[model samples]
Target: MSWQMADIWENIAQAIPDKPAIVDGDKRYSWAEYEDRAARVAQVYTDHGLKPGAKLAIYSYNSAEYMEAQFGAFKARICPVNVNYRYLEAELTHVINNSDSEALVYQAQFAPRVAAIREQLEHVKLFLEIADGSGEHLDGAVDYETALQAASPMPVIERSDDDLYMLYTGGTTGMPKGVMYDHKTFSSALFTKGFEMREMTLPEGAAGFGPLTQALHAADAATRSIPACPIMHGTGMWIGAMIPHALGGCVVLFDNSHFDPAALWKLTQDEKVTDLTIVGDVFAKPMLAALDDAQAAGKPFDLSSLQMMGSSGVMWSAEVKKGLLEHIEMVIIDSMGSTEGSMGASVTTRETTESDKTASFDMAETTRILTEDGKPVAPGSGDIGLICNGGMVPLGYYKDEKKSAETFRTFDGVRYSIPGDYATVEADGSVTLLGRGSICINSGGEKIFPEEVEEVLKTHDSVYDCLVVGVPDDRFGEKITAVLSVSKGTQFDEGALNDHVRANLAAYKTPRAFITVKDVPRAANGKAGYKDAKEIALNALNLEVA
Candidate 1:
């Protein structure tokens, strides 16, 4: 039988019941206690009439209860949907409605936003709010702790490997959609040994799993990991929450709404964190800056216990990775993956080659480059193709058949997840990822779709037309830039345009800089010319293409 995540957690809890399972700020939960808390949360959901397989939306900052709610949903065979806390009213309402969420669990700080959209979300039958040091509370919403304490702990329900693990991801279409994956496939991507790590084979079968499970508990000391990114993201949740628990280790979370390098370093030294996960240069740059400042101040943090530091989603520059290696003699695994697919080409700083630094990656054995004609492109062919992952992929986007068909396809009788990433297989068989074909802007690991920003910018009174593009940056891998064609004789007000976008969408999606153009360039078919807009922004910013 294929292993389910809930079952795996139960097995690990049985093996290491007294060990710390999760440490969030000042709060800690032992393995046994964590399971008990999850059971209570699950019972609360059922008591509220949330049935098995019902969808629950988690909308909050990184917290222990956020994870408890997630595991509880898993225990109850309920699907938990990750809601980006950065989303404003419109975006939040769209996702909650699209997911058919029956219940919403959100932080009290975001109560105003939720309250604004509550009238539109008729399907959401229950609201559970966690106090965020704010005295604010939404009317008619149940307190999270009150509900958890009142409910009786329920027995773990039988779950199949086919249980749903849904992740809502923003795409080039300018809206967020849920990517659907069964627990079996998700586990294969997260837990199974990759081709580069070991022999490429399926995860242990039922017959071979007994000894492995026993050895997993007996042979290894308790490991500790800190997820520097938000748990709402795939990298943070998997590396920080799920993977550690699955391995019977401890997951430490910083108790802050924003990332703080000093606090993160302090926790690492204090807890002796074994694993650390980051997202590209946005995280690495600040961390390195803080480390440098700490050493100069004569109180260098002892990160000796850190075993591995990894990044996913955005680009973790080679310079930053090398700097991190100086502080700790460990490899930096710069994983290139998305919510739609896992384990593509991972660029590692293990061997430290001169040229193969940041964007270059060693393709996984099952990963391949397929041309538009559905033929495998040979290495060094100089042909651009979609970087695809074969075997045990997601089912498809929930309720979006058009996108699901476009993303997951079958070629030569084998199905693969083609996530719209353009790459070239180098002569040495390494892959040099060009970028996303969808033109998604990644600013500090946050995905910002150009159309989403463009739509907002065009709504400005001074703006007649606009196109948004990503420009290279030192801190954030890419920053948002907007090229505009204002109304005749109307001057561009950057502040006004920025505030417009910030009011309508997440603040991060707002343009950092604006450039006036003669006219917004468009093709004959009336499509925005992103290439031209990108060049315009780069020239205006006086940045050279690296």
Candidate 2:
């Protein structure tokens, strides 16, 4: 079916005006209220001189206001750029200015940071702050709710299906790049993936949106998804909010800034949520701990309502998935993809999990593994190639044509998005993802993917979390080092870790040293960040890293 999220959501608002759209803490907003508030946000953007094709960046946590502001940009036919909330001054300025953001909506807590760089970001013309009860406000900034109350709801104008939808890179390796998608391309993928998750197909014609939503609601198939990760990120927004909203489902947001597995479980129980979105093991470990603690306390949560749990962006171990399955008896989805384009995912239920392996995923229809010379890799030939995606790919990075051309290209007359993720083709038409090539380690002139070693470390009981990095070594040229985190007073044996790594992978891939840190570096969205880990490893060797 040909439809845009803006038009479909607007129609849903008219058809089911009283349906719950967003729930943050004790606050609830229905479809009518959601549309009205988003329209007011659009009015605020208009009043600040933002027009179609202008960019509006959202730098905030998972809150009702965040999604409302995003939807407002969608309605205005403007690009909504996501800003990482954990960004410092320079990073903040780079993102806002790089995206050509004319308007910014941020949380009150980040006002000082924004103020520090306000002069540096010449593109920003308006600043709107969402209150966090800190009373911290940016100078000359508009209060979010106050502006909504004062301005009239903007009239629903005809928005182009070609309006851009941007998702900035996580910036773990370098400065973030904005990946742009026209609403038509993105919305089509959204519907296709949404229906695929439900084992359904999109009905034909322009009038299908309302009926599909109503049917799902009538069948109690409408999801109540709680995104435990940051809403500013892709997984949380796409799988957490957008897809659920498309099915006329309600999205629940936790009030706290930090992740509390116990609280997330409590909220899931209280909301009777059907889906929970999270980043891989960084989120799953603590959540599993919380579940165990509750069971020990004889006050286990009522997770019976939970039907599916999805994780992306980082490594999700098979052990964690089995642990969660034992408790909730729900489907666990491990997605292997990036913001640029999705390749595929692995969904595990209780019966199918015995063979559950880490990082092995079924391929999407348009996904392929191609060698450097633009030839498809033969299945089970033990040849490694870059994983490329074709259908519904991005337009390119916002303004960087060089990087865009390198990533999005036509190989053998078919356009594909090759984002530097190396994998091997399996005999069963699957791809065994070997981490990103940019960060792969070259030790003794042998290429090694960190994900393999990291997953091996995670299998150890004493290791809570870890990041593997390469440090300069005199003999091997580069030493594989592992930075790890564990519970206080719990220690790991280096010999045992080495043995474990050797058992799973070759001796060359085993980490030479292990450094303990209170916490491993990860992005706000829980994706592994190696910049800090490399520095920490180099510091252990008295070698400078910068």
Candidate 3:
């Protein structure tokens, strides 16, 4: 109960001072240096008059600095709030104001947006800027490196179990809210996941971490994870960075400004990465294409070192996993979770590929499928219910008691985090994940999950990515629409795609209208952004859906 993230990490740094802690392109930081930098960042927090339980938002891309500030916030007992890098002025302002953040650490490239909304953010007292060579600077913002150089490292202090760790999630369905977790439960679950990833358990307590990490490193079994997505996302921060860091592994970040599959593959090969964190098929498809292209060019990446690739927050199609397996023999892990809590995960390998479906998962004992009336859904019954995670649930959403009570509630005297995700329990106690109930479309009195329809559409040979949304219709009350980004060098046939959907799903579930876009909107966390799709569909529904 006494184990703290920063405290354990400081001891790890003392034990493995010279070991690589983070790798980004040509630069690397050792464990001692990582700790020192984070401490200096904490100094900045202290200097800004931020006290215990104070909140600060991090607005930056994936960099070593992003993580240093997070760890620093932990040491200083400040709540680190993650701001999506893709958010516009309105969305950014809502997150900062909603979270009650007093300080901001932003990348220089995003200075314009910050400066634009800086005046509106009256609660924010400090702005710490990280420079990119882009020469984008903001007035009244403290330069990151300059501050670290000017300030002495803030010494470590005892931290409380109730200290906060906040992750913002809404994923385009609505405005993002900060999901709150106490340090005690969050870090405990994180360490459990990290050790489970290695097929081991924690030795005992904080005292055993130094020896365990040293032995693992000596045995050449240190975890090296690549957070292929933006670190602002929970998947990137929790699974990719914090978990691996807690286990004393070096986190390898992509050096590319944009998502380049070739760059990611080369980074994994160069770093001998043991695991990677991605957001389902959205990332897997492009990465698989890169492997094919690179191999055809007579320069296949050396992916023999990669042991596992994990995806969450979106669909990871079965075919995509098979395609990746064709190139490298690695485990494909699909995790189902949101900022609220982890529901379940499924692992697919070459041998198990035939039996794996895109959305099926094996649940932990703490997770249960419950009906609206507080009864557990019987296995083998075709009943759908909210997938509730029972143990170690979030305290609640920050600053929204109504939402908190609705999301994190007590069902039959046990607290659970049920974020409106509906699913059914199989006879074997596994789950068939339908989708989020909030986004489900009701057409002609029949409910249809968009993810179920989207999965069928993505199976088309011409489709690259697709999002399904319900649009207003006079007859059906709501019409199903498809927003697609076609595959490269291919043309889309709405009729053929509709037929494909009908083949796999019910006729009513098939999209009533089809529209093409250059890109399907997704949150920074790689989850579907349905708002844009609905607007696009409704604007042209009358002309197209007849």
Task: Give model 1 RMSD, 1 decimal.
Answer: 10.5
Model 1 / residue 232 / CA error / Å: 0.4
Candidate 1 minimal-lDDT segment of 10 residues: 194-203
lDDT tens digits by residue: candidate 1, 432-536:
776677797889998776755665565565776677889999999998898988765578888888788889888888888889987776532123567778888
TM-score versus the correct structure, for each prediction: 0.80, 0.98, 0.96
lDDT of each: 0.78, 0.87, 0.87
The parts of candidate 1 lying over 4 Å away from their true place are 193-220, 347-355, 440-546
**Per the 3 Å backbone cut-off, how many clashing residue pairs does candidate 2 have?**
0
**How well does candidate 3 match the true structure in TM-score terms?**
0.96
lDDT for model 2 comes to: 0.87
In model 2, where is the ten-residue run with the lowest total lDDT?
Answer: 202-211
For residues 1-546, what per-residue lDDT tens digits would candidate 3 score against the true structure? Answer: 356778778878988899999997776899999999999999989998999889999988899989899989989999999998888999999999999999999999999999999889968998999988879989988999999989999988988877888898865457898888888788887678667766888755556677778987999888899999888888988888888887889999875357888889988998899999999888899999999999899999999999999888889999999999999998888988887888889989999999988788999668989998779999998888899997659999888899899988788799999899999899998998899988999999999999988888888889999999988788998888899999998888878887788889889999888899989987656688787777777776543433
Query: Comparing candidate 1 with candidate 2, which one achieves the higher TM-score?
Result: 2
Pairs that collide, model 3: none
Clash number for each model: 0, 0, 0
| lDDT for predicted candidate 3 compared with the true structure | 0.87
Query: Arrange candidates by TM-score, highest first: which order?
Result: 2, 3, 1
